[model samples]
Target: MRVMELVRFGGADTAFATRELPQPVPGPGQVLVRVMATSVNPLDLQTRRGDYRDQVALPAVIGNDVSGVVVETGRGADDFQPGDEVWYLAPVFAGLGTYAEFHVVDQALVARKPARLSHVEAAGLALVGVTVWEALVERAGVRAGERVLVHGGAGGVGSAAIQIARALGAEVVTTARARDHGFVTGLGAGTAIDFSAGDYAPQVRAMGGVDVVLDTVGGDTLTRSPEILADRGRVVSIVDISEPQNLLAAWGVNATYHFVFVSPGRAKLEALGRLVDRGELRPVIGAVLPLADIAQAHTLLEGGSPTEGRGRPRGKIAIAVHPLDQPPHGTGSSGREE
Candidate 1:
């Protein structure tokens, strides 16, 4: 098995090293998968930069999203057999991550890959899809005919939220750059506001504040959310609150706040698969790089140099671990590689 291991906690350029290791054998209730693709998330960037040094040890394989084919199953792991296509978000800081060509995960954490999505797309959506599902469906309980405001609509989580909210019959409004208006709208956001142009609160207020606000961009967004929230509106935040905010405003509006650090599982992946199979949810891939270019993928996600001709990543950056030569939105995997 080949892996891009995090040798140190530092910049993307120096933190990672490619190495060869023995393939892991699945334990009871676990399955070994031949990783087809994996996607980079903000969590990966944080892990690479030492933000979670306490949780991750040096020389660790750190990645969450994985879409692959089952190669072997452990004793009692009857949920899937060899050659079954699957996708999952590896438990954060688990023993080994999906950065390697082969990964072992509890069978309970894996789900059948959505038939409509290829390995690249499934890998890109796994983590973000689970995060958004936790925020919108399980936590906020977003309902039909309601207006939902999603911050950072062009981002991985934000993009998935837009599609999920729309699938729930809620009207979607997202915050994004001027250039991404079309992109967000194409994903079913009814309105796209450029947060940089001016105070977006006033614009959102103008159209009668939203019933739910998803805070992907932290900073003052949490504190200022009351200004754009409807009565009893729910606010869900995935970003960690680094500073204290005045929540007195939320009291007046009867606002509810839920902070989510996603815990991945197969149930959430199955829920997302239902939507994907229905054509209501789709993965938006900004770029795809080979496993050897894992460092470059991190750089692109961190807004660093060498975009590889793309101006900026619009969606998730996926690593082709098995080189399926599959298109971004290809219907399914072509075949297994050895």
Candidate 2:
């Protein structure tokens, strides 16, 4: 099987390369998926650059999101048959990835793909959707009538968070640049603040301080979010919150800083699947590239040279792992690759 991998961590061009390896087989309670598509995330780049070397093992296959067909199912995996169409977020710390022709995932972490979406769209949702869902719904405990602020609203997780919050009846406000304000608003944000214009803290405060803050962009934004929180408001950040003590002390805030490490859970994937199948949510694909162009995909993800006339790609960039017509090995008709 053909796989993209990194022998060492460094530049995207230097670290990522294609190689041939033996196809993976399903182990007990696992399933071998013939990958149709996989999407890139910031974590992929970060891991590839040795940012998490102390934590993650070397020579890792570093993708987390996938939409694929089940080619084979192992013992104790009676729930999912060989032909089931599935999507999942791979466990990152364990280092089993989706950037290959086939990936073996625990059957407990897989869910049927949303009926309404293509494999491309489903692939794009696995990681970001789970991240947003966990942050807003699970950690922050966002309620229906609450005012929630989502920072970096145009990015993958931010975009998904906006739609999910709106669907749950939360009054959503997001920060984006001028060009993305309309896009964010169209996604159902109640208010879209242009971060480029000025500080977002005052604007959020004027709207009756937000009940929850979802900070996707950390650094200064994370530092400033606590200031705009309502009394006893919750703050969830996916990025590092460097000044947790200072921020909490100065603002009379009881902060719950979330360092989101998205886990693979079948129940969460099923929830997202139901939302997509019911037309309540949709995945945004910023660009599509062939498996051979994996390097270019990494470049766009790592803030490398521009593509599609934008300085950076807007949403998920997916890599098509297999052609649409082929039926993956070990499966019959229903396992046709998408």
- Using TM-score, give the best candidate's number: 1
Shift of residue 2 alpha carbon in model 2, Å: 0.5
TM-score against truth, every candidate: 0.95, 0.93
lDDT by residue for model 2 (193-309), tens: 998898888988888878888878876766676788777788787874456434644356766666576777989888887777767788988888877777788888776475455
Q: Rate the local accuracy (lDDT) of all candidates.
A: 0.91, 0.82
Could you tell me which 10 consecutive residues in candidate 2 have the lowest summed lDDT? Answer: 329-338
Candidate 1 per-residue lDDT, tens place, 166-201, comes to 999999999999999999999999999998898899
User: Against the true structure, whose lDDT is highest?
Assistant: 1
